[model samples]
Target chain A: MTNKTEKKGFSRRQFLKASGAASAVAGGAGLGLFGYEAGKDPRTYRGWENWEGVNQVFNRKKYAVDQPTCQKVGPTRRVDARTEVIFYRRGSFMRQWREETGLEGMEPHIQEYYRKNPEDLELDIYSQEVIFPKLMEDRKKYQDQFRLSDAWSNAMGAVSPPRITEPPEVSDFPRRSRRGGSTEPVKFKDPKKTSKLIKKIAHELGSTLVGIAKLNPDWVYKYTSIGRGFQSDEPIEVPKHWQNAIVVGTPMSWDPMYANPNYGTSNDAYSRSRIIAFRVASFIKQLGYAARPHTPGTDYDLMVPPILVDAGIGEQSRPSIVVTPELGLNFRPAIITTNLPLHPDKPISFGVQDFCDHCKICAENCPSDAISYGDRVEVRGYLRWQVNTAKCLNFWNSTLGSMGCRLCVAVCPYTRKSNWIHKAALKVTADDPTGISEKALTMMQKRFYPGPEPQKYYIPSLGGENASYREPPWWLRTEDFIE
Target chain B: MQFFISGWFWFLEGILTCLMVVGLKFYMEDKGIPMPFWKWILFGLWILLAGFTIAFVGTSLGEGEPTAAKLGGILFGLTSTISGIALWRILLTGRNKT
Candidate 1:
């Protein structure tokens, strides 16, 4: 054995030389991966020229001029007032049960699971035992700190209901005398041009995406209970004269959205949308027309998702939320019902349904198994994948000191940053009308970015020190607008 | 500090580890020693797995104060020490036999 080993012995000096050569090769490979070009300023890499010239070669915009409009596969039906998730939660029976038994109407299995695995109940206990109690004890202060946007939205709730009377006439406004006035409604001469202008204004007022649809009566709720709690059983009727609807979306920042089950981060998108919707409604009103904005924390007669679909904004994904080409499910939609004559957009189909069919990441990662992995089914007249709302709400109420769950938004493949690599993939997926590329794309996504692991939220920066709910940034709070 | 939490740090670490393993293999070959290629590969994989296991267990058992970076650093240190001991054994075995 010694003789055989001696024959294969290597000198230290020779080994050192070989190691140096290998190091050089490795260094070269590392540099190659960066794809750095000589004499090019990296800071100027994102200039318009790069986007229009070089980037366009790889990322052809996926929109087609003559793509067929998407069709609703089933007949439309009004959502039953009793069946609505929020209404059911607010019902006296459920509220009384929640107060009597601290279970929040959770299933037996979920409570049992928590009881069986006490160690895994850390978050649940911390939320229920500590955070929620403190928040409730000082409700006003906590509301200001944690739910500033919600409070503001609630304050603006009076505007959400249709006004009983028109505003008092301004002296300077061009108008006929009231006694023998020309009562003819003002005609918008150019519908297409006016629609474009409205969209531009909405975008300027902080809407991420803006689309118009001829108001579908089926999308309107037959009756809606206003405000929190079941104080009055009176149902508000939606007026039929509001013939057009403007759907607007605003995106939540990724940092907060990624920190799911957390209150401030998860609800920031909703708050931002509320602010935008209010401003857009005001703008529309100034154009000599009636505009009623439906915002978060306010009574709403319209179902937002179906309206968004009809407006050509996005398609509903597996989690029963609209996923747009630009932002996936990381945005909130608000509606402005108006009688303004505007050209409505056709419903768009960019292969989102096919991609969602193949990619069940959201369903798999859902803590409550609330998201469905099955095919679309007709529900209340719309053919779509529906989530188990009871399971989802129960999970939300039981964890993380917050009444929300954004796990679906956090894990969506399309919720990636708009970098070059993602843009390329998106372009390809959008162009593949037949959805033949979905399986390969899904595989690539999994390989590149693995699913979230257990106890993944234990990082100190994400949870302990900087874990306090994030306040809205100055830009979000300030009223200043750039021209 | 942000780099540690960001995904890029892991990518860089993976590239560095691969390079280190390649260099070690080349060094053994140049020394005229018939490389125990399978043994080296197994050792590398074992170290990686052990490091990951330590991080997972440490974070799981810890009160919510340990960041991913802190746990990752602990894993790196522990794995590096083990790898050094392993390499020493290999060198000693090779030299003494010769």
Candidate 2:
């Protein structure tokens, strides 16, 4: 056995030398040395330099392309399905302004009043909070009367059985062609006529929110690394056919989602992104114009932040998430870079930068501490809060098995549902004219959506398929983008 | 030489060990009081142990003399000891609690 004194004692000089040596070894080996290499990412914060070589080991970088290009447009149409458009009525009692003692007088008698009038009840149900408990009671009574629990059975007092919308066919897949093929950019007979139609088409394609923005050169990545269609530079002189870009966001199902923030809980986000991209791409191609979808799974050509900013979707927040009015940060974005020539939505100034200045909720709840509570700094042309991708990626690698983490998206305040009441306040706060409006909105959001408290870490699971808490599979590589 | 030089060995070793620890920890943390200190110690020990285990298991099952068998022995002993200690700590902790 070694002598205890010699073996156990660690000198400051020895520690320093060891640390320096370790960092040097890590940096040379392509590991970020505890995120020391975050400096390499133009959009990242310096504080993220903690996890040295983690970024190299776990990130799915093999998919990275040296220069990313759009896929070839093929012949396909979008499959449409009649689906329930869930309109959520947030529990009014849960709102901050109201105190709930469950008292008789406090129970909004307005529900009982509407129950008497069918015409009034339908109107009230659209805008006002539906009496969920009453509905539950009525459902129970009906079930007991008919002695039926089958959702498809109308035998119960239930007037109509629950029905799913008809799903679209596989033929609806979007057409693809190699970038700049024989397809002349679909010409719009009139620019004014096209923009309005494009906006309307975007909504039908399952985009909860859509905005048109002029494509800026800065928004395009300095270089592309992954995905289909290869272009080295901005195609020299831009094609006159392509002009405006459409930014779209698909919201996640809040019920299955609010339960956890682990990667498994985030499967819904990816699935939604795929669905929206597939549908939106098909819709654009059907219009006989060129439209390319940018999804995390599909591309490295364009940056989402710039597209989102130009489209006026939401203000960038401190946790480095896009904060939209309706979904907060809970949405996964899909971009359709097109030449349809549409009216551009001006980026709005929602004191989001200032709100994020004071709000560190995501940072507080981040189990990996990937988020920074630090002030925003200049990156390229814009000033924004940047996370340590190395740290974030490392945590994702550890917790999510293969998918990586979406807890930042899960816990953001902007991710709240856009209820009627919330919409009213959002409309007022969207402009954020004076800094005062932003301050008020932040206060209101803080009051309504109290930030998560720090507690022991809990690993949220996605039930069976992705239950193994293993690192990602070998295929999905984020490291291919690192170099 | 190529294996270690390429860093694939270390990378694979680190990843395997990390996965094992994190996977076990995920299941274990939910069961009872978190044995934080013991877990930390076990975490360090397993890296050394698992690394050698991979090297050793490869050799013993294979047809040739293990060129890295000396280092392989060290890895095996370290892994065995660490796993034993980790199990021992867990058992002892559980026993004391009971």
Candidate 3:
């Protein structure tokens, strides 16, 4: 047999050297391009700074508060002012829907699904045996210190809202520093400086993304539900003077999120956000302002997406969630409402709407088909793509394998790690404004990372799990230390 | 049975299987074997089915065993299948291609 290498006049060692040199050149060129796209400053591509000035120009132009989009009062009402979907009212739907479905509730429904498919049940069992116990242990260790509420205990009105009894206490030092031992508010004359300082403080205290927004009454919930049963429906009266909101978002780990819809990574992200929010709220309170932290497991006074949008943190996407430029949908936001004087950020327009319009990946991948494939509709006064909440919740409740279905968040092309390629694509899409760059980027994403097959039962593999989670580093595993 | 009960042993078995498959692929390529892509895919499917069967049988028979043992059994089965599949694909791709 003729030797292919000799026939081609290239030895293996010579070929390897040539290829190595070529790869080195290619790698250098790629890094150079990435450096240029990232900007001259190294900090622009590092940590929370990636979001700095990301969609500033576009946001200032299109979705600014003074813009026509914000000016118009449509049929679906602006999210900030929409009063129809109160917390208790929304909670009531779970019971009503459970009756409608004729299933006992989510647990029974999940049990039925597993019973029908023993193989899937086996997979679930394997995960429970291998993965969930450790996750639960970690959660138990951190639950008291990190989480302030237990809204996730029951998705229905059975545990609608957990009550907050004590008011946020201001620090003794700040209170004593004031004249006559009375707490006098430390006022900032410059809103811009205050906003910058607040953002810096938030970032330092573990916030992945932070922004400020002028408080909108429409965002506040009409009533808060505290605990289950009759006493749950308590009317909440938020003081109008709480004029500014400090919005902070913490990004979840990509590895576990990619691994499964609901996992330790998702829960950990929420816990971390709660801790960050609590600290931020306490910090604001020390400044002599009443600051209330609103986290995932807490009763929310304000709708998060609109507040995030108005804060210039992200744009509203098709899944009816805020998609940040830096983290995409892989983030959980916590809000701190305060009377602190701060300048609100302009709402960004980073072509998320355009990208979501073209990429129906989320809608297609939705387990229960809860996401809408159609154009943006006026729902509760906001002209945006609205998901079928009932259907979405039903899926969340019924999924025995996972806690919640974050398939949309997991599948989003934008929800990628902070790599240069993704960053470059983001820059291109943002700069174009027109859908041209977005279309190209979407196409590239589809080609490279094609969406997972619909309804394929994800069994956590024993050792060779393709989407398995990385063992969390020592710092994250707080369970190691006994309290 | 003793090997199947040990998690680390199963894990080691998976690694060894993976290494062996890799070595086989390299050896086959050096010997100029013209393995088709579809054949590799078919072989992978067979390996996957075999792995599934091993897991199913092990779990069913060792009902009283620790959950970790069952998990280890399933993991070893899966690892073997994945290793085989990966090797088959690597071999089919050849040295110049992928």
Model 1, A351-424: lDDT tens digits are 78889888998887776677898988878766788887655654554333333567778678777545434455
Please report how far candidate 2 places residue A157 from its true position, in Å: 37
Worst lDDT 10-window in candidate 3 chain A: A461-470
The best-first sequence of candidates by DockQ reads: 1, 2, 3
- What is the i-RMS of every prediction? 12.9, 21.9, 21.5
Candidate 3, residue A137: CA error in Å? Answer: 22
Give candidate 1's error at residue A176 in angstroms.
Answer: 13
- Fnat for model 3 comes to 0.00
Clashing pairs in 3: A76-A380, A76-A381, A76-A382, A77-A381, A80-A218, A80-A219, A81-A218
CA lDDT for candidate 1: 0.56
CA-lDDT, candidates in order: 0.56, 0.46, 0.56
Tens-digit per-residue lDDT, A136-227, candidate 2: 44444332321211221122113321221211121222344666434345677776677667656655555566667788655554322231
Q: Best candidate, DockQ-wise?
A: 1
lDDT per residue as tens, model 2, B1-98: 33432457457546544454544444454445466675567656654454335433343223122333344455456757767776666644653343
**What is candidate 2's local distance difference test score?**
0.46
Q: Tell me which of candidates 1 and 3 scores higher on DockQ.
A: 1
Worst 10 residues of 2 chain A by lDDT: A79-88
Each candidate's clash count = 1, 38, 7
> Residues A345-425, candidate 3, lDDT per residue (tens digit)?
877776777788888878887865779999887656567787765456444433332345577887787775554445656
